[model samples]
Target: MPTSAAHVPEPGEGDGPEPWPQGISRRATMRISDVLRALRTEFPHVSHSKLRFLEEQGLIETVRTPAGYRQYSPADVERLRYVLVEQRDHYLPLKVIKDRLAALDTGTETEAPVPRLATADGDAGAASARRRYTVEALAAAGGVDRSLVDGLVEAGVLRPTTGGQLDAHALDVVVLAAGLAEHGIEPRHLRTLRTAADRHVSLVQQVVAPWRSQQTASARAHADTLATEIGELCARLHTVFVRQGVDDLTR
Candidate 1:
């Protein structure tokens, strides 16, 4: 039988006890609170419920003690850290992050490995926090007209942030709008793209329906993995189609 990737530790890494508190052992365990404390400085926003929610989402797994309290191993902690960092820094959806990590664990030859950027502290980490952009800033960065930005906001493509500011994600709409302008494709022309995207979302939902229905540990993992694989496959196919079309047009 092929060895499972989850069971394989990274190369040159030992399977010795986690270097947690002096008293803790590989056989020993810690409460969710304790784990939170260990990670709080780096992940200040982390909460007990958030950890449980991540477990529920199938992003990470935890071992249970005899009393049914969660006992996270050092390996599990590392996994959780990786997941959170990816989300905070890259703005990656959980499903994508989960799939990438799983691929790493399994040692699969996938797309170029996700890039890990360096933090200000000289430690390589994900972005520390989300950045919000003002409406003016959004327009400036994307080089789009203010009217177009307003139109997108009205159409629900971009939403106003707290205090009516527009964040970077909201600014992404402006970027899209600017690109469309180059082809005489205004925001209105892109409505079809939005509709198509909605349809694709439904398609993805159907693809993951089986796993979603179960909601078990294994089910979540499978769903995350499947979503990643399908997403990657779709991206690759799209590139191939574009290349083929370009070749045909040139011929």
Candidate 2:
């Protein structure tokens, strides 16, 4: 005979729907079943092991009953919803989400709205924007050699904008390099800086990818905000480290 759904053991269960082991109460506090049901309603693929994984990630905390059974609260369920929403829509990693949540908990207002870089009517609008700059215009703006601008593009530091021209942001980087060049600095000298930046970006991406799996608008916003905040933090830490190194050398 085929086994039925009811016959199958629910998580933390035996053969039947008997009281939870150790006489745990199903009221007030939520059981694992309630969490699974709620999460499944919103995110159908949520599994018991995934929930356990979330707990391990420190995304949610559970209370244990006297008999050592895990119990989730209503608040815990809501937090899980928030976390899943962020991960699916925004692709935020667990550590970034946790840090953002911690900041919110401490009443820190560090989140910023994401700016849309591209718009509808995409190619034409983008093209028109790029046509505004010529090679001379970009050289003057960024203060770098026209050849350096080309190198930056080749290096993937600046992307081609509309009309096959460098994008405004990419031009800005060249412009900044140009200013530095007047003071005897060169692009080659800053190659390590670019490499460091790329490494930092990869670190942030790895941290946010799991959260990107749970797509929702709010979650996406949260992930973007968290990424920005964490990136800023990493930059600040790098600055501090450099300063500390200099200080030690001077001392």
Candidate 3:
């Protein structure tokens, strides 16, 4: 998941449009091409330029990689769902839609009513609800030592709720680390990943500062969409490079 900072935008930032859901999970990021392809079936007129135009209109915010690539999350996808549905059905312009979104950002209700979803099949789904687990239960499930679990928490990798329960994302991290442990990697060694994430997050934070400063619901979400996608690409690139290194030695 993208490490979304508190989007309390800097003093000078909100002049531009802000973003969408902050702290969105990095799972299931979509490239611009992928998003365009997915929406094509529903809106035959959907185009790359159209999505960019929507972004320019502050309709959506996207994530960017270290080298600059756009990534979209399901929340962003869902928002697109709302926008397109409203446009096609109500014939509302972007200005009208933006106002409704602003109301939502302010935690107020919007007078403009849009259908629940935009997809033709009505498949605007969401991530499953949070599944909580105790530290002991998580350790057992992940097959990692208790000490390792402690190390992960200490290293700021896994965070337990105030009630001492781990959310699904932390649990998933534990499980992955546990599998790596069997191969002689240890939690302490995992700190590099954490460090890398922190540094990249700071860099990405700089890139998205303007959007965050605005502190809009859509702006926050857009920052999240962008961060999560970059994180995904970074992870994939790391894994691919490591595999390539191994393949090279074997060759």
- Give the candidate number with the greatest TM-score: 1
Write one digit per residue (lDDT tens) for candidate 2, span 79-197: 67667767755666778778776765444634622222212233442343344566667877766568887766666666565676654566668867777777987667667778888
User: Cα RMSD (Å) per model?
Assistant: 7.9, 14.2, 17.7
Against the true structure, candidate 1 reaches a TM-score of 0.53
Candidate 1: which stretches are off by over 4 Å?
1-29, 33-68, 73-75, 83-137, 140-143, 154-168, 213-229
Query: What TM-score fits each model?
Result: 0.53, 0.43, 0.46
Instruction: Report the C-alpha lDDT of model 1 over 1-251, residue by residue, as the tens digit.
Output: 11112333333447653221212123325578777876665666677766776787676666665566777655556667777766555546778777877666555634534433222242322132345666777777677778888777676667686687775466566876777777887666767656755666677778988987884655665565466556655646667887999999999
- Compute the lDDT for candidate 2: 0.61
lDDT of each: 0.62, 0.61, 0.65
Off by over 4 Å in 3: 1-129, 143-145, 161-163, 215-218
Error of 1 at 54 (Å): 9.3
C-alpha-based local distance difference test score of model 3:
0.65
Which 10 residues in a row give candidate 3 its minimum summed lDDT? Answer: 121-130
